[model samples]
Structures are given as C-alpha cells and as structure tokens.
Target chain A: MFSQRKFYTPYTSPTDPCPPIEVKSYETPPQLYLGFQPPCLPQYASAKEALHRGTLWPALYSPYESPYKRGDTGE
Target chain B: MWYYEKKLQYPVRVRECNPRLAKFLIEQYGGADGELAAALRYLNQRYSIPDKVIGLLTDIGTEEFAHLEMIATMVYKLTKDATPEQMKEAGLGAHYVNHDNALFYENASGTPWTASYIQAKGDPIADIYEDIAAEEKARATYQWIINMSDDPELNDGLKYLREREVVHSQRFREAAEILKEERGKKVFF
Candidate 1:
C-alpha cells in the first residue's frame, strides 16, 4: 500500500544571502581530543527551503543556458 | 577427435586409513538419497522440465558427479593398506573382516544400492520441490557425519559436501520461483 506524500520546503538562492551572525568564545577544556563537543544546532528554515529546491549543502548546481538540437525528429 | 585427461579435483596423498569414515562416506555413492541417485534424478528429470529449467538441472546434476568422486576417494583411501588391527580399532571390523579390503558398493550402513532413490516424474513443479527436499536431506546427512568424525581431514571433506547442499538447494528454489512466475503469466482466457 502507498502512504501519504509529505511536502518539503525549497532552498533559497545562495546569491541572496546577507545576514549578521554572532560568535561565542570559550576556554579550552582538558582532554579536548577525547571529550565530546556540543551538538550542532539545526537551521530549520534554511534546511527546509533547500530541500524544496533540490539544492542542499555539499551539493553543487550548474547555472547555464543551451539551445541546441541533435538527430532526426521524424521530419 | 579424442582427448584423454587425468586430473583429480581433490588429490589424495595421505596413506593413513580410517575405514569407519570411509564406510560412512560410501553413502554418497550407493546409499538411498546419495549423490549418485541425486545426479541421476536431476539428469533424468530434465527431459520433463520446461526449457528454462533444463540448464539448472544439468548444472546441479553435473556437480553431483563431483560429489560422487569425493565419496569414491574417501572410500579408496579408507580401505587402502587397512590392517586387520586398525580396522578393529576404527569399529569397522565387520566390514574389513567380511569385505577384506575390497570396497563394496554399499551405503554407510553397508546397505546395498537401490534405484528407488531416484525418480523422474513428468511433472516439473513436483520434481523441483523433490530436488529441494533431497538436497536438504543430503545436507543433514553431512551434518551427522561431521558430528561423528574426529579427523580434521575427513571433517573438511564433509564440510565441503554440506556447503554444496546449501548451494544446490538455493538453485532449485530459484528454479521453482522461475516456474511459478512463468505459470502466473500464462494467458488461459
């Protein structure tokens, strides 16, 4: 049996990115190599948007235009 | 055109004797549900099977020939240079005392070979299912032999035979699946 389909949000255009971000500093802890680091916070909106556009991080996109034809078209 | 080839799949170089194990392996040759029976069963049944199942039956039947050779080697080695005292120690005194180093064509229990082990009914589905059950039974016999053996060399041979049963079972199952699928697609309307 088929299940209900779920919709995902699309990604935003990378060229339109412009925002001010904050940086936090902390003292180095002992046994830094063995100790675990804080889990990464999720960016819900951006991730949802990227899913919709079929463009996610670590994935590249090609932006170009071509107008060419090949072979016979049953003419 | 003629060709003569002399090559053994398993070269037997050991001279030690283990008549008990040898007697047990003889089942593959002359026992009910033995390799000889299995080979003859599949080969003869091929005629009744659909064209699609012919290759599968042939391949399995050919492998049964290899199993027959393995069993023959085991019997030959077990009986070669077997001393009366050694036979007594291995609990094969009765066979050695009666057969006198000659390999009688018999099962592990010294039962004579019978043709009833093989059948070639003109029904492909029934025959394929029978082949599957036969392979499983052979595998079980191998397991029993392995459990009873202490010699590592003899155990290794039994292990190989056991693994082969698994492969043959799988192939027969695949053949059955193909038959079922083909029948399902038939247009009777």
Candidate 2:
C-alpha cells in the first residue's frame, strides 16, 4: 500500500456545496446573416515574408525553392 | 496550372531491384486511392468549395502532386535495371507487355487510373468528409506497402507519406467543423 494514497484526497471536493447557476441573457449565436468575421491573419514583415509563410496565397506561393531548379535531363 | 518537378518530395533510393514491389508501388502513384486521385480530388473540389476552405484544398491538393512524383520515381527506380526474365519472374511481364519498363499510370493489378476514382460532390460537408476518408485509405495503403517491404530506403519515404495522411485528415476535420458551424447559422426571412 502506498503511503501517498491518503494524501491524494482533496478535502474540498466532497464537502463543496453545489455552486449557484448564474442566469445568462438569451444570446443569439453569431451568424453570417448578421455579419461576417474573417479569419485573423498573422502579422508579416512584408509581402515576401507573408508569401514565404504561405499564408497570403498557398497555391501560388511555394514555401521552398523548386525541386527542379536544374535543367531537365532525360533518364 | 502545374509545373514539372524533376525531383521527388521524398528521396526514394531503393537499392534492390524488385520489380514486384515496383508494380505494387505504382498503386500509390495512380491507383484508386493513390496520390494522383487525392491530388485530382482536392484540386477539383477547390473550385466548388467555400472561399474560406479553398486554400486548404489547394495546399493539400498541390502537395499530393509531390507525393505522386515520389511514388512514380520509386516505381521507375525499382524496375530501371530489371531484366525481361526478371520482370517475367516477378509477374511484372503483364505490365511490361503493355508499356515495357517505362512507367504507365496503373494500379498494382494493372488497372489504369481513371478520373472516376474521385469526385467533387459540390457539397462542402460531403466533399471534406470524403477527403478525410481518402486520406485514411491512402494511409492504410502505404502501411500495406510498408508491411510487405523490408527495404529501409523505401520505408522512410512510405512512412513520410503515411504521416502526411494523418495531418491531412486532421486539417480536413477542422475544415469540416467550420463548414458545419457556418451552415448551422443559416436562416430564411
């Protein structure tokens, strides 16, 4: 038997009273019908930096240099 | 819209000449659940997907092209030095009879990869879920290939491809939840 077993019990949990439920106002869910919230973009030093991060445009901006930088040599 | 990358995404330096493995590897390049199917599926789906999710599709779809190259290169290297007798002995003669040692777009069973392997449902929810499923299938296929192979050179590449599938699935799940929530708030006057 571990001596630490008795020390593991938190005395507050069982003796704690049921917390009062705070009443909240009827909150309508956020909707595009009301307005739109765009995704928060990261701050970049420059356009090049953003492009390098591939955040501005992923398809057009490649993060790394092209693999086929050298001239095509047939096998 | 596409550029040829002469190099593979992952280096595949298979030292052994196993045409049989090459035949099986072809599935990853052009099979039903292959990288080509994934690339084509996501790229085509991008057109119909919501603007917010287009980037996700574009990024993943484009990356699939790199995987396609990696798998194709593996196949090429595996069979590059295989003799006709070796090819026949390895059961690659059927493929050889059709296209010889040159790479032809086909699955392990020699079925040509077709556009029908994927579809753009025009529904974001369905398409994104389908994308996740496709990734899972591709991951399983890579595991199958890894199981059959003892080559360390090949396993490294396969493991990388398999890990990518897990990441892609996670991204798709995020995209799906966003789409679902956005749809939930829709109302008619």
- Report per-candidate DockQ: 0.01, 0.02
Candidate 2 C-alpha lDDT tens digits along B7-123: 766667786889989878988988999999999899999998888899999999999999888888888888998999889988888887878799987888889989999988898
TM-score of 2: 0.69
Q: What is the lDDT of every predicted structure here?
A: 0.65, 0.72
Instruction: State which candidate has the highest DockQ.
Output: 2
Candidate 1 lDDT at B167 equals: 55
Candidate 1 chain B least-lDDT 10 residues:
B1-10
Candidate 1 lands at a TM-score of: 0.64
Interface RMSD of each: 27.3, 13.7
lDDT of 2 by residue, A1-75 (tens): 211011122234544577522221111111211122236634565876543243342221211111123222221
Clashing pairs in 1: A9-A52, A10-A49, A10-A52, A10-A53, A11-A49, A11-A50
Q: TM-score of the A chain in candidate 1?
A: 0.19
Cα shift from native, residue A16, model 2 (Å): 59
Clashes of 2: 0
Top-lDDT candidate index? 2
